[model samples]
Target: MTDKAHVVIVGGGLAGLLLGCVVATTCRDRLSVTLIERALPEAPEESLDTRATAISRGSKALLDHWMLWEAVSNEAKPIEDIHVSRAARFGSAMLRDAQDAREPMGWVVENVLLQQVLVARCEAEGVALLEGREVVDFCATQENPKLTLNNEEVIDADLVVIADGAQSALRESIGIGAIRHSPSQFAIAVNCETDGADCGVAYERFTSEGPLALLPIPNGSSSRARYNVIWCAHKVKQAALLKLSDDDFIGALQAEFGWRAGKILRVGRRTGWPLGKIAARELVRARCVLFGNAAHTLHPVAGQGFNLSLRDVERLATVIATEAGQDAPFSSVERLSVFTDMSRKDHEQTMGATSQLAEMLDSPSPFVDGLASLALSTLDLTGPIKRNVAEFGMGRR
Candidate 1:
């Protein structure tokens, strides 16, 4: 039994790793942290993470504060402008960084690279990262929380954080139910080469099928521009699109996305998964708390999923640090309540905005289409609306 408050994070994904790094660095003397991940963190040089994430400006600042931003800065592509339009629609809007000062709106980086950098930083901070271990059972109380791993290892902790993802067994075992909503959508993701120059522009084009986002990425030594494509489609169309050859898929994409960003010269391998919104009914339970996908999983329409999670990490870390500074135990109900109170508004707003945008945009009714077009046109003409949208997208508000 250690004198320090022990924290056991039950997941090694980006959110879990980030929380570990934050707490370990912020309250190292007062808190002992352990991260139990089923699989070890991948080596930095391993295969690139097929997925890419939009790191909002707020998230960037948090990463910078942790001293992890510089490590991945070279690979991150800044988005100077974002163009939003609907296919064959009369309304379109473009948000520029200049409108809200000259700061870049956000950055896009490969998932694997970010995780690798964070893992390295956590280890450097003396976080105990236990790989290939999973919690088979969990027992929580006001004073102590316990976990039983598959290897029959029973570990005790003062606090437990569940970030194991949407299908989180730990969250379920703790009697926390998730409110799930499936929009009958699937997102296809892939990397592609474009003929356009690297101008730090991103596109969010909506079509009859669903929303399509083309985010810029660091081209490195290559002269040609490159982008990561996220195209959401209904299940029926998704199956057909996934079966098409590379050339046919490119043709379909070009037809729907138009030639705004130049022609799609070549496309890399494509992968996809089902799209849905999953939010845990309760974010806090006694000495246990849910983080990241365990708390809420939103549609990728606005790229708010990871950004919201990063904000959660920042707030939770602040709460823990404040308590530790005062020599208060983090697992106490009072401290945990403070953490929840601080984060509730941000979580609710993010979840509400993301889900509402997804639902409104995906509606097939003509009334909805007309309303969306009007909204886009209004946003373009209204400075306050545009600024608010930009700020929200950048995770500033």
Candidate 2:
């Protein structure tokens, strides 16, 4: 190995790629990064990812700092307004971009597009990309951390970052316990074509069953308006809905979402996944650390999962930049402790708020429903409350 401190990142998904890019650019002279991904990066002509993430303004700024916003701007659809309402209830609220300056509250981009952009940025920044490689085992020591790939190849690094995702085998192998909670819900995702014009509007409609979100997406050169749908429902209902025909699924969605976005014209390939929350007990151990979903997996009600993860990456990069030196670097206990201390408040707040919202909104209790309605009404009438909520969603807080 070279004299530079080597950092090995497991997983090449959004979090891993973003972390790699940020570290490679921010600490180029101090560290060398190698990203090991299990699968090869998708080709440009491959199908667009069905899943979408709401990129808050804070995350956008972070991407801009990395000089990646320009490459993804054209493909991202800005959210100018967000409408929140409950089914057959008087409580409703609308969040407008004007309330938070003229800038977009957030932008929506497919996972594939984000991955492509980050991959390109990583390549340009000289972050070594190892495709089709998996870290099956790892050992963290005071001097050098080691990762054993499936092919029996052992790679040594000064620090190891796990971004392998929610079901991280490496994290489990290292005996890092996670607090898991299942709200007995699942999320169905698909791309939707609507009859309305592209006005950069998004919707979050809460039903008796769960919360459904419709996020705006770029219509490209076509005249049709498109939105990404994330419908959270009970596991049983989700299973039944997933089996429905395309037309039937659209009808079901229209019933829950109403005609706010106009009639749902068509629905693309539908997919569903179990929804749950997982937070690792400890974020850092010796020379190893957890990032992104490996640190926490949240419900999608607030669309804050990826946004929060990006913030973690941002703070972590800052800590590494400040603590790293020729003598003391990423693997030292001092660096890990500082990182943990700095991140605790943000992590607790984001996780607590997200978990509470998911549970309260999805509860079947009539009292909770009344409280939810009252809360929305309060948010609608109170400017301070609304602004605070909006800023929180934008990852400003």
Candidate 3:
């Protein structure tokens, strides 16, 4: 008789829950899966928070496999066009039209809504989700992977996947080497109601202050559109910006954002996050592996962090399922290396783009700005460059 394989996943966020669903659905009666999370799977209200995310085509494809896309697509708005510009007149701005890619570029999502959908799907698929519990320690032997929770319950499995956040305690416990770099900028995020016409466009404007990204939000039949604003600036300036009255802050945002869309009214609370990147040197060892922020994190300049994590989860699931079907050692070093290879290209591309973009925006030299201006102008007229960037950003190519 075949032994029942058990899989344990730590962290109940998007990555963790989605991974659980994949295993439960693909493996079916072959594997038993359990997910542990510190927060209860509570329903979220309709109000928006500082929590927002962008889902790329790659991630959408993974969700579609599970028939979960419809759950989220309604809450997201397609980014039909994106305008990238600099605050200073010295630099040139580039416009990337989604039509060039023959598909919607991506969808901007609210975090709570994403969690609700994933949690519901996991429950329906027979993935055992344990809430109000945290993993206190994790140990992986050549034979078994064991997780001890704060409540003193222990779970042993044939494989363990870690989806914990960047500062993952379990990752540290497992001796995963990670490198971190501070971006020296903080992101201020808010949901706003526009007092003007609705335009299904996104903006990624870089200024001496920092990058300000305006993402479109879902609106009803009304012609007026809403947007989620994320502004990156020096930490001190971020604090001052937060202190401004709602109307005053809107005025400041309008001065930089222009009247293309109309007046911006605050619709949700504003929150801030320090910008940085963290990457683990190795994602897997023996029967244990890491995913999500536990493996890597990126600055929100491109909103690629969570999307990267989702890619990791999706590929990992595919690798394991393929190996299991062949009765091969899916958690073996050789098989896990396959998963690593799949992520390297995308991760490297995203890292390179974000780093280059951030450095160009932060640089003070006139020569560097001139070069950036030239590159922007060249990219506009260059169809290959524009198409390649759009495909890369959407995870299509």
Candidate 4:
């Protein structure tokens, strides 16, 4: 009886939550949105993820487009410059936001805070939030796709957006499989205090063992700046690193990261996970689609995962709003395929860049260090190439 198409989004992570917000805010007249989150509000304190994320300028624009930027910006710290260099190497690249002095290349935010802001936006926009639940299975029919909830509730929808994490059971229910890259690796993430003051600068320093990323995050009332550290390497090295005492870990970090952030004064508890490239073989089938880690999981070396997914969500919302005025909705198999095609170039470019960086990070060859150094130093001096790189990094292009 209703003209508005129903859109059921599975997973309340960043991707799904943002998708629900965009669709509900932009297409409220044309669509009804529902979001399913498996985790309940009473999640244990340890269950709340404190990891930080770097979002590009392009992503900020998308958030602004949906009127959610103000809330996010309040909690975000800007990245004015990104320093890329290999430890004890001759070459380095410094990329900055040259287009507008008022704008930054990117912003860093805490993951849990971002999710909270997104959930609030979804609720304000009238999105149905089904917390503490999940989609048990997908009924993928050609005309009307549907989702069966864990509570045995069946909801029919015109489109299903799967934004679950990498291990998505619903994605598998639809016969979608993910491919993991070879040569296993791991990354250790931690929060630490540095001896330097906060200048809104980020660093990517490559070393003999692997690439070290030190991203600035907000630290409360501390005299020295704080950072989120990601040290990636082979599993053997990762295990050895994780076993070190906090002081030993700080010492090890100070040795590899150098005096860039001054000294590694203090460190919080460290957490790590095995790293590998994972991507869905196909993104869309009939009335269903995949987004976020479900579609492609990239190394955080480049910090492109969430930003890339945000663009897709924004564009899809636009398409939904535009097509809602038509006699038929935009959730048809052919139309969804077209949407996937439109996003192909970005996904390919980002995934390729992240993979290559990760491979270089884990390479045992001494020559890779020199190659990476030379590439970074050379890319810095080339005006057009550097501009293009800056544009790509900021997601402005």
Candidate 5:
């Protein structure tokens, strides 16, 4: 077995790339790092899968650390306000105005743009990226961890991080157990153009169909640039919804969602994905660890899916980098413990928030709607509680 590098990452997605960027910059001369991805890297192009993320102050801080924030800041729109409402309720709850915390709750960014920034940084940091290569097998022992690539190359390193994604074959190969639950629903995502001034706000409306989220995108001149939408509905309803023409779809959306953004215009093609959750029974061992979706997959109720994974990537990179800096036992059990402890609180909190919201929103009964209204109203009334909730959801405090 070859034993030259200290760390090997098994995925090239956002989480893997972010971890690589952080580790590459911090441990450049000390540790050797390599990243393996199954697909070739490509530039961002026009696609119907117009997914976007509400990056919290915390996420922005992490990105700023590597100096990539400025590069992609132009593609983001700060969410100065958030309007949340229940379809059954007469009035909506507002989490805006000053004193809504110290900053504009969070910034919304396109997924394609974010990916482009991360990929560029990874390349700039001199990370050894092996594209079109796959991890066919991985075996971790007490002394060393080894990975076999599809290119017939084998690598033995002090630590191996599996970031292959939610359906991670690495997780399965390692004999790790995870709980998978289907929420009996699916999310249809699309991008729509609006004819109004961009208010720098986000809207989330809960209906019997599911939760529909509208996030602002950066369009310099007017709000007409476009907004990203994720409409969750039952599997049976998805087909009919997707069959509507763009104009008819906008009319349907307007009926459900009022003129919050003035006039809604063109909509890109929509893509549907099943809603589910996956949480590994355990996330760490002696010399191997799981980060990103490999560890947990939450319902995308609050757009915390990728940001939560970024937090994991950051924490794991810090733990591993600090361990690499020390002279004592490398990849020791204690090092793994550090990762476990650091991520325990945040992971539990995020999982609890998203899972609870999913369950609460899934029930379309009047009672549930009343409960939802009361909860939001209470959150708006209580400053500390609301701030904490916002911080947890925005990946900041």
Candidate 6:
């Protein structure tokens, strides 16, 4: 019905909404974008998620370029340093910005706040918001991809983006298989307030039982040290953790994580979920492509999941914008292949690093654990190595 190429995105989670905003902002009037989401709007504070995500420097750069950084940073807390240690071990790694010394490595924002910002920006950019509707079926590889809603209404698109969750039926129906790489593990997330000064430092503690992470977060108008915790464990340990009282839980976490950031005075509600890695066997096919969790879902050991997805969004936006009005949108499998190839390195590197860390620390070999402890110490003392690791965490790679 219009000259602009039609691009239909299915899903409205953080990934889906952010992709819509980034693409709309990049292509402007050159593309017509529509988002099909099933969830209706809710009160801002009544969130579906209570967890927070770390945004790397590379991701911040993309948002900065797109002029959306301010909205996110307004509610984000900068992570100035990261402390890595092993439970009851001698060696530790204190990672700081020794390189370019640009801005803080990254920032942490609540998932709810981020969704609010992305949704607002998406609306402001004039992307058609076809919310409160579900796509019952989709055929994304045709000359003109088609989406059928629950109401049996059909819509055609020159290109289709699938940003649905990791368990995406649409991606499976379209013939994309996933490679899951993870052991039997689960994650428990909780927020806490500290009794000591927060030095804008995040912590990653590796224990014999599991790995635990604590990221800095905003504490409203108060100056108290607030944090979001991510604790990973096997089934039995996970069950034990969930069964503990709040006070006992804090005590157990304090014992595992130590007092580098001071005592864990109090904790908020806790959430738990099974953890794993899910990567699509193929990222693109003809006019169809996968984005966000639909393409890859990762372990939170390294806090790279959402940031990696944002990087993918930026790359796709630039590529799609470049080809707009010059080619038949994403109708070319070759063009989509270019995107896949260009993004492969980052994906492999990020996903590999996350998986390795989780598996390495969870190894049953005492020798490997000793070596990992030594590596942490060596990295801390080795200025160059520490700098490189810090930058990698900052998303420089």
Best by TM-score: 2
**What TM-score quantifies how close candidate 3 is to the native fold?**
0.90
TM per candidate comes to 0.93, 0.95, 0.90, 0.92, 0.90, 0.94
Q: Candidate 4 — what's its lDDT?
A: 0.81
Please identify model 6 stretches exceeding 4 Å from their true place. 40-49, 99-102
lDDT of 5 by residue, 179-268 (tens): 999757788888888777778888888877678888887654442657888888888777778889888888888887888777887787
Model 5 C-alpha lDDT versus the unseen true structure: 0.78
Clashing residue pairs in candidate 1, if any?
Answer: none
Locate the minimum summed-lDDT window of 10 residues in model 2: 40-49
Instruction: Give the alpha-carbon lDDT of every model.
Output: 0.84, 0.84, 0.77, 0.81, 0.78, 0.84
Q: State which candidate, 5 or 6, has the greater TM-score.
A: 6
The 10-residue segment with the lowest total lDDT in model 1: 41-50
Clashes of each: 0, 0, 0, 0, 0, 0
Q: Give me the overall lDDT of model 6.
A: 0.84
Superposed Cα deviation of residue 102, candidate 1 (Å): 3.5
- After superposing candidate 5, which stretches have Cα over 4 Å from the reference? 1-4, 40-49, 97-103, 141-143, 220-223, 326-330, 377-385
lDDT of 3 by residue, 154-218 (tens): 88777788887888887888788998887678889988778776667778878776788888877
Q: Which pairs of residues collide in candidate 2?
A: none
Point out the higher-scoring one by lDDT: 3 or 6.
6
Query: RMSDs, each prediction?
Result: 2.2, 1.9, 2.7, 2.6, 2.7, 2.2
Candidate 6 residue pairs in backbone clash: none
lDDT of 2 by residue, 4-115 (tens): 8888889898989999999999888888889999884553342323567799999999888878889988888999888999988879999864544868889998787899
